[model samples]
Target: MRRHRHAKIVATVGPASSTPDQLRALFLAGVDTFRLNFSHGVQADHAKVHAAIRDLEKEVGRPIGILQDLQGPKIRIGTLQGGRLDLQAGETVRFVLEGADGDKQAIPLHHPEIFDAVVPGQELLIDDGRVRVRVTGPERTSITAEVITGGPISNRKGVNLPGTLLDLSPLTEKDRADLAFGLDLGVDWVALSFVQKPSDVIEARGIIGDRAGIMSKIEKPQALDRIDDIIRLSDAVMVARGDLGVEIPHEDVPARQKELIRACRLAVKPVVVATQMLDSMVNAPAPTRAEASDVATAIYDGADAVMLSAESATGRYPVEAVAMMDRIIRSVEGHKLYHSIIAASEPGEEETPPHAVATATADLAEAVRAAAIVAYTASGTTAARVARKRPAAAILALTPNVATSRRLSLLWGAHSVLTEDVDSYEEMTTKARHHAQDEGFAKPNDIIVVTAGIPFHSAGNTNNIRLMQI
Candidate 1:
């Protein structure tokens, strides 16, 4: 099957549509990637979906990308004993770590991590900011708070700490287990949620052990602050605008999304714009014009992928949402400016070791009108950098790492091949050309760009470039 020219569409799977037949319909409807959210389902359910996707891939004779998103640390309040508590404006309430024992007025606060991070005068928003609490005590476990415009306090409502840097790692024990389970399933990508620093990506990758590509979710303000470092460290990124909108001002989400797309493009890492792209379609058959424009904007901004959350996963119109997203992407790609934006936003050569070589090779590819650019990367970093330029020729990313290969498959204009390590650039180029010709991707006389690091077996040292004639 031929690949789509524009950015790919990633449809999430949920209870509304998790069957094999539904997944096949989504694939046929132009979903290039499937996202499995570990936050909602059990391991067995995810396994079923994985097996179904593989079966469908075999049936369709094309590789499909699977992204497993680990639920990061989700902070929430403890159980409410009185069921629901209400407080008037400017009323003082104590948020204690202990359970509510027949307390009709106050609710218990769980998650001691929050207590450790919160200081006096810090704002705590519960239930998506429906209930606001201001820390007014010694900032200890027994912090005092005055409920500001409190509503019905349900059981275990989520807590959002805006502008407060909690001293907590993004990955929880649940996330660690989920990461392990995802690796066992052999997923192509593992998307870590609420990533704040590059260290989170490193830690997640260490646990994944090169078994899956790390896709960092840029949803928190802290993540935005360290975006460049995170981009350099991650294989892919997602503009997770849902919680981001909640954390930051909603008006700022659009600008942040654009900035994130540009950053990832410059890094040559695949970027996905996700959440509420077609939110209305969750219940309605058609999408609002605003939602349609949002999807188009991501495509025009040169994102490698656009995702559907509740719309395709738990929505009433799963198939229709996927079809609509496909239509929107195609329509946006038809514009002449789409290709121009992609080409113009291409990443320049990094001054770093292998980046310099990859840039030189990319320059030669453009000059020689090469049939393709071939990059040998164990970590998939070099290939990703080459792809950022949005070259006219396709990228044949050769990697011995299976996880890297599968992850690269979802990137724009990238075709991954699994092969053994080559001793030299010459051997790498020869094998690349052979593979290209064998796959009917190149002619014997065509030119090809080859790039690899010196002393090849060493990881993350891509420092060589060559122009070869097939």
Candidate 2:
């Protein structure tokens, strides 16, 4: 079934919603994609979910996207003696290379790479920024830091280095293994976590090599600096804010989110605003006011998709979370301001025929109050170009390649459908128009804008546009 809203929803599959019934409920609740978080589940676990999803796809006759999120070099604290330690603000604590029984004064940090790069003035955030530390001394393989924001730091809590760029590869051994499994499963997208540079994208792209789309998870500060290059190399980008909020100041997260979204929009690449969108809904049936607004803000900013992590993975209300986010996105897109905001991000082009035709199709559709902008694409380029214009009408993309149709789901305002390959513009036009009518995008005598590449079945050959009455 087609989603009423333009923005897509990506829901993570986990213990809370891994069954056939649960997964079907999520898909029916408007989840356009299913994320298999490799950090927690094994290949076998995901294989079941993947099979179930394919089964649902067959039942519904819709192309569903699957994203495999690879966990990168994630560092965590060593086991504490009591499993918990309270650090007071301004207290000096020592983190050494050797794992040890940790107390209020000392903790174990076996990752020497962190100590190698940390200096006397840099800050370290422990336990997701709950306990912040300012490095006061660096002696050999140990670091002495005074707590800046103290709290109860639990065993194996994550560490975030805001300023120091650590010497680490984006892909870890575990991530490589996970990537192989996901590619073998034929997942549509593979998201590399903790990306720090463009070379990371190069490395992942090298391994992926057209097997799947590479999505760089932008969470670190270094990734922010090399964002344009990373976006250029990546098939898509994910604004992963869990660890990002830990490194960057909380007050800066909103602005940073907007900046990244804007960059991806200009690049014509799909970006997903992820992490804790409806986190409170993980337990409560209803989302918090701020959380609901947070999701709407992303949609307003023209994010291609808004994601749900724990809210759908281990949450008690997975279906409710998806339905809630779908409602919020639909509501926001219906607002008058949402139209202006997304339209304002229209891309500037060098004025080629394909670009000219794509723009004209959007403009013509709006001028005629057409049912939708129907795009017949092979590589999804023409549809992407049209979607970047953010037309008032829906973007209905018809593709013969199922993979292209699946990947096109990530693009904002592009609702992809799979159909048989056609030969001529007339055939493409007839197919697109009929499909729009069948999909309820138009009725008899209704007008719709149709655009396609001149060389049928060829990539990036869009040069023709026409208005057809259904």
Candidate 3:
């Protein structure tokens, strides 16, 4: 199942699309990766869905990527009196650090981290920014704030603290348990939510080790301050515009999304533009024109992938959403300006031999109009490096590790296949030609570019290049 477009699609599996038949339809509809969101489902539910995806993968004869998204700490207000509260603008409300029910005069904020970190002037956004309060007084055990945007709020509504850095771990107890379970189940990637800084990525990596790739989701304004460091530490990045838009200005989300995509491309890491790409499609058979443009805009910005959250997870038209997203990507990539835009945004190469070789592979592939660029990658780094260039030729990634093949499914322009290790130079060329033809990337007499490292099977040492006629 070779995808026609360069960018990949990640669809979340949920109640609407958990069955084997549903998953198989999604995969056939151009969903390159499946996201198992731990935020809503129980472990048993996720296990059954995971098993179905694996079964579908074997049936389709393709390595499909499974991303386990760990729900991070949930910061919310405690129970309220009457289970609800309505306030007007310019009114003062006191939020106390207690578990007792609160009336209109006082609201209970359960998390101690907020009390410790919040200061005067910091805004507390409740229920996804529906009700905003500016902290006017920060006492030892309570905070008094003036309502800037007033609305109805109920028990356990989520709280977003803009411009406040809480000294809290990104991973809660539940996330740790969920991470272990997903790792044991052989997830290819783990998308960590509630990331504030690079340390969060480092912390997740400590537990993950080499078992799975760690994807840092940029959801807080704090993450933007040190985005470079976070991108460097992460194997992939996600522009989680939902929570991020709530924390920052809505107009700023687009700029942040573009910046994140460019940063990820510079780092040679896969980046997925997620959330609300096809929200209207969740109920309707087709997406709004604005939503279609949003997905296309991400493609034009050189994002590695665009994701579907509720649109595929709980949407009524899961298959249609995937097909629509696939069509949008193909249309954008086929646009005449697509190539020039990607080339113009290409980051400067690092001053290293491996990087230089990767750049040359792309350059030669385009110069000779080769059928494909075949990369032998044991750790998938070689494929990522070549993909960063966004070459015209398709990327045929050959790896001895099935995990590498599965992970490469998220990368742009990478058609990963499982293959045996090459012990000699001739063996490498023969395998490249055979796989290129076998994968429909090349035919007899068609030219192809091959890249690998000397003393084969060495990871991260992409030092050789060869041009071959298949």
Each prediction's Cα lDDT score?
Answer: 0.81, 0.88, 0.94
Off by over 4 Å in 3: none
Error of 3 at 289 (Å): 1.1
Residue range 127-178, candidate 3, lDDT tens digits: 9999999999998788999999999999989999987788889899999999
The residue pairs in collision within model 2 are 453-462
- Worst ten in a row by lDDT for model 1: 98-107
Candidate 2: residue 331 Cα off by (Å): 1.3
Q: What ordering of candidates by lDDT runs from best to worst?
A: 3, 2, 1
- For each of the candidates, the C-alpha root-mean-square deviation to the true structure, in angstroms, is 3.4, 1.6, 1.1
Q: Tell me the tens digit of each residue's lDDT in model 1 across 16-131.
A: 87999999999998888899999899999999999999999879866788999988987777776656667566888777776554243445776787778878888888787778
The most accurate candidate by TM-score is 3
Best by lDDT: 3
Estimate the lDDT of model 1.
Answer: 0.81
Superposed model 1: Cα runs more than 4 Å off: 81-88, 101-104, 352-379, 396-401, 417-470
- lDDT of prediction 2: 0.88
lDDT for 415 (candidate 3): 97
- Residue-level lDDT of model 2, residues 1-470, one tens digit each, is 78898889999999999999999999999999999998897789999999999899999988999999997999898888689888889889988777465865568888888978888888888878878889999877788899898889888888989966888888888898888888988899999999998998998888999888889998998888989999999988999999998888889999999998888877778999999999999999999899989999999888999999999999999999999999999999899888887777655663677877888888899899999999988888889888877787999999889889999878888989999989976788789878998888999999998898877868988788888898
Tell me which of candidates 1 and 2 scores higher on lDDT. Answer: 2
